[model samples]
Target: MSEHDFHVHGPHDHELEHAAQHEPKGFAGQLAVITAILATVGAFFSYMGGATQANAALLKNEAAIRKTEASNQWNYYQSKGNKQNMAELAAELVSSEEQRTKYRDKVARYDKEKADIKLKAEALEAASAQADEESAHQMHLHHRWAQATTALQVAIALAAIALLTRRRWMEWGTLAMGGVGVVLGGMAWLQL
Candidate 1:
């Protein structure tokens, strides 16, 4: 082969040497990366579950409010005392009663809907919790995951700091811990 071609393929070539000379991230670096990923996942699911619960609660409250308003309207119509007004008011009361009944029915429907939503939210929450637990367990398996997966993501930045400082051990440890935090955060965000 030509000298130029030989140089290109040689192990001592600049590109090859540069790539080979790169510092090893080692076990710690791998652990940190894995932990961070897991934590992020956990956070996402938790947020989703919480948001579902909140929406269900809001719907339930709205149903109650509507029912209350309907009752108030019915009572107001019944309270007027003039005979002519009373007669008209009585009719209005009946109409209001119908509306109240409708509202009550709506409330009942909402109640059922809310119950279903609540159940779904609860199930999601349980899943989120289980994910968190698993992430935490992973962190325990490797300290790096636990430290990097904080709920606040402060740990992730901290992991970067450790990396920058050439503190491979700390970096990995932080990353391992962060997996659960990430998962929980992700869950919350999804719910929102």
Candidate 2:
């Protein structure tokens, strides 16, 4: 891309503004300046909002996968518990001493297996919670960005009216709207 793309009016943006400072205050100049600044800020907010929303979606998906894994582990742990219970019952019912000893051994094995499964399930749940928290934070960022975008859009619309009517109050109203957008954009950056 050309260097001109970086500035609203190529390399002459500063020069143009300096020249405009010496010229008479008029609707045309004011409209040009305000519209340019608003467009630049609006573009930045749009890009940031898109990136944040994408990150949120990815985190949400990760959380869902972790939750599913946690659920599967819990189910496996329950199955192990059932096996342990059945083994205990078998030990009580069997008449032969050798068979009773085997059932008691099986019960011990299931108990050990259940302990491991429970740990795995708990770890997965923790991971899911972390992912969910991050996803929620990203969603909050997106909300601020959305509000900023709306304000910027309104400012742009007001700027158009100010240009058409050459009304100073309309220009001030447009500036106020842009201020709101900037504040919201800053809030999104702070993420607090």
Estimate the TM-score of every prediction: 0.36, 0.84
Give me the candidate number with maximum TM-score: 2
lDDT of 2 by residue, 29-91 (tens): 777899899989999999999999999999999999999999999999999999999999999
Displacement of the residue 74 alpha carbon in candidate 2, Å: 0.9
Question: Model 2: what TM-score?
Answer: 0.84
Question: Which parts of model 1 have CA positions greater than 4 angstroms off?
Answer: 1-22, 25-36, 39-43, 46-50, 53-57, 60-64, 70-152, 179-192
Candidate 2 lDDT at 30 equals 79
